[model samples]
Target: MQGLTPTESISFILVFLEGILSFFSPCVIPLIPIYISYLAGNAKQVAEDGTITFHRKKVFFHTLFFVLGISFAFFILGMSFTALGTFFQSNQLLFTRIGGILILILGLYQVGLLDIKFLQRERKFQIPLGDREANPLLAFAMGFTFSFAWTPCVGPALSSVLILASGTGSSLTGNLLVLVYSLGFVIPFLLLGLFTTQVLNFLNVHKKFLKYTVKAGGILLILIGIMTFTGWMNGVTKYLSKFTPPALTREEENLPPEESDTASESDSAENSEAKEEPVKTPAFDFTLTDQFGNEHTLSDYKGKVVFLNFWATWCPPCQMEMPDIEEIYQEFDKNEGDIVILGISNPSSAEYPDNADKSKEEVLAYLEDNKYTFPIVFDETGEVLQDYFISAFPTSFFIDKEGNFFGYATGLMTKSQIYQALEQALAATEQPSE
Candidate 1:
């Protein structure tokens, strides 16, 4: 439910750039002429004084429909990937690890270090252009069918993107990512349709550059794979977030006295007229003891803004953000104030061996050694983690004072972001009944 953060924005930009690079793939750029010829088969062309001119009006609209068809196919692909992601959302950590490994192998294939035969083989539907004129309908059908025409050439890049899309937090995010990539791949096609002669001349001249596109994309995928596998992307995201200006401030807390009085009067009237209903508590509630042996239930903290952070002892990003959590905990009077900060960890045990590297004893010892005073709790059975759909380490959830799910953020967060999220949670109002 959160707005696009700096990390998401950066990811979208990279996906868009990847799409643009896909257009210049070996199978794509070289075959542009053939595709254009099919699209503008009957359009007039004039050759005058060593220069070429295409019938722009005739070809442009056809190209538009062709790209639209490609876009439609891409959208469908995005939806399918997103749906798959949603189904596997609970096993997010497993999905990320598997996806990272797959991406790494694909990167190797792209760099020529590995030989993946299926990837090297191209399989696409072929449409014969014997005598049919290039009308908008035909162009659209061609664009849709031919989208799979260069699968082998674009597969590596496209697969990497689909893997990313499948791991996103929301279906909408995954779909938007694919849309951005489609824009990158199709914008060039649209331009070529408009200025076919000029683009063909440029491509013919600088054809040497096309060979490097795969290599560049391969290196990028490799880096992303390593970061994702090691859980370092969250740290990078946290670092980048430092450059984003704070979205909200505490100035609103210092309203004028007259305005406060008026608000208080309005609240009094509303409270008198409004009937009180039992506050709905969410289902992820649990009774767990902290390191100090004091048990806590999520429902018990209904009147307070709860900052529940799901982390692991082995996660570097989790360790990196501990100090900030400690600082914030102290600022909030160590949970004595209206805000309560709790760290949830699922250490490795016979029951949940995949959850963490350390045992519960080791986790407690680590907390003691680090002198982290914030309340640290254990999800011994790991049910809490499943209920929360925790795919990545250092994921934080914010609950409003009314115990409603305000929103959540994945990856590490800075102190400022943590504060902003808490503020937003505190300011959030309850959803009305249907």
Candidate 2:
């Protein structure tokens, strides 16, 4: 899989760090010591003589269970924020701005620039019904309750996850994405809990780092907020979409039967009159490489009917028409006519203007994945397409035997339409030989 961009990687790291810091906010941090003390209540005092200082594995498991509960609670909160953003389409921008501002405020709070009284309000939301006595399970319940009640404290981290989820285009994927994000936060909390005393001691000695860390986080939130407000982030995403290839247009589709028949009659009458005159045509030839790296020349297949299909990997209609082309190829393969189907994949690359660096291997993979077995040629330089002045995808040209251009189609074609064109080419080529 392709790795994420530098910006995406940095953003994810910031979000993960924000989660850990939120867990250590003043409202939540002091309570961790209280909860640990409660869980170790009489056990620690009885073992003060060092006779039974170590807790059993059961105690550890209970503590971990509480951690799981907190993670799940946060995950659900993230889901709710995502759902709220998705349900109302008209106020999407309004909600996005609100979320961004909320994140900015939380960041400022972390830097001690702002203090909201509501941030300190804590309620006993998670009641432990079964275990009134202190156990690891009760501690877990406390952790879960803390996650729900401390929403204002961790708003920045939660907002980041909700923003990511909203962009996923579906609520289900968004919810799961936040769950993964919660894991990013939960892992550190579990580790800190395992060695709480050591962590507190380390924090005391390196207290200066906390201020700088919070400032750095604040700056990141400010940048994200600015980008969100100005729509620069969305613009960047939109600009990237230009790399996608163009699709077929409706005007390029063939005319209906009545019009087609009239046009055909007019052309036939004109051709009958022009038969008495002589015409001169330029010699056209070129060398190109197929997807397999094999070279082919137009001159080599001189006395044959060749359907040259010019297309690109990114073109959706081009992708759709491949099967019809393949069916035509199969029919012609068994016929007496010297027919050949040649596919030219137009090149596109970031380095090459108007072309992409879509490798031959990648093109082959796409074809194989889609079950396309046509003989495809590569045109990384766009030499063939430019030479023919072809501007649309799936442009097909019928070259009769003896190298005469019979006719062409500029857009998508059905199986019947292609077969009819092939029959016309066959007739045109047979007339010269007869």
Candidate 3:
């Protein structure tokens, strides 16, 4: 099997961060202090001055053992999920649907719409020995028990890992992958334990900030839930294929053409034809309807320079880039006949049930809430996305006025970058440069 791509590695790192954030959730956030306190209490007695002194070496080793224990538990969980996924690979869609439903239920729980008794269960593991006699193995067991008991708090993060594992199509590999994910969470906690007093003091002073942070974390979980349950992640992946390096696209394009040839002579002829045919760079065309029911086709503005964007209300990066897109849009909207800017709302499936036929009303509400006033379209059925082949949020296509595609961006674009691209597109239009 091919090694994971750079993009996949980056995505995994983001997954790791998501795991860390989930570990710092409301239920788990406040308890970090308590855990530290418990560990601190286990410290050895100080001199007669009444100061408590901890054996730093012992503390460090204990924390490390605890992290190892937590990591082991997650490794086992990942292995189990991977095995189950392998067994059910024949029913991939059924598994995906089931996972989606479970994610949705979890989201509902986060939003206070639903609750599960088992999910609320929080059992702590205890070591039946003195701290002085505590073996690393016992500490590790406690760590495993801690992780198992806190399943609800870590469910969102674990779910993400499980989703990735299931998609990997290999049980052992997938399980190991999630074990790495568990380390991403455990490492931070172990470090915090090393500076227990400092961290506890900081948390105590900034308790209000911590509350909001946990709230934000909860909201993020909810977002992840929506993305998972609605199949938005799959859609994003599909869209991202559009921006895959040209080499991969060319190779893929030639695959089907090659498969169709039977005879050697036919294959030679097809190869000749392939050599002659220019590699076509991907482009996007979509129809957007305004609140007034006016329809606009991106292709209709072909003779004019255009900026095409894919975005959604719930996406933070999308939202962050909007004001910049809007600033550029305003500059060009005034010169609409020369440059056209079209922003398309790419809602996750959970947010848009009808898919491509997503209502114009919802778009309006989104616009109003986000304070965006650009020419916006809805890619409910993802037909427009199919043409563009985008994978990430805020993909922008810069088309020259002569209908020649100049270039595109796959992630968030800064205001200056948008302006620079627009300026380049405009200059290309005026000079007819390659």
C-alpha RMSD for every candidate:
10.4, 22.5, 15.1
Tens-digit per-residue lDDT, 1-434, candidate 3? 01111111224555566667757654345345334544544544446984444556666677788788878766655443345533433343344455445445544554456667643321111221124344577668767655644444455456445534533323444666676678678877788667754554565567677666544545655554455445555544444333433211111123342342233235434544554432222234556675446698767886788777776554566778888877777777543668888877654455555343235566678678877777786666655653453444556767777564565655566676567567656764586322
lDDT per residue for candidate 2 within 244-360, as digits (tens), equals 233211222356745654555575456556554222121246788876667878778877777787776776667778888877777777223588888887555544444432666
Q: TM-scores of all models?
A: 0.43, 0.39, 0.37
Error of 1 at 283 (Å): 9.6
Point out where model 1 deviates above 4 Å: 1-85, 88-200, 208-304, 310-324, 327-340, 344-366, 373-395, 401-403, 407-434
Q: On a 0 to 100 scale, what is the lDDT of residue 309 in model 3?
A: 77
Best by lDDT: 1
How high is the lDDT of residue 293 in model 3? 60
Ranking by lDDT: 1, 3, 2
Model 1 Cα lDDT, one tens digit per residue, 1-434 = 12212112225665677689779764355346446656655564546764545578887988999998888766655443345534444444454565456556656766778876654431110122223367888788767655644333354455445544543434565677788889999999988788865654554455467447656756766665665566555345434333332221121235653564355446534643663432222425788889998898989998899999877777777888899999999999999888999999877787655453479999999999999989888888766765564455677777777665555555667787688668756654443442
- State each model's CA lDDT, in order: 0.63, 0.53, 0.54
Query: Model 2: which residue pairs collide?
Result: 66-140, 348-355, 348-356, 348-357, 349-355, 349-356, 349-357
Q: Which stretches of candidate 3 lie over 4 Å from their true place?
A: 1-282, 347-362, 432-434
Show model 2 residue runs off by greater than 4 Å. 1-266, 278-283, 334-337, 349-353, 432-434
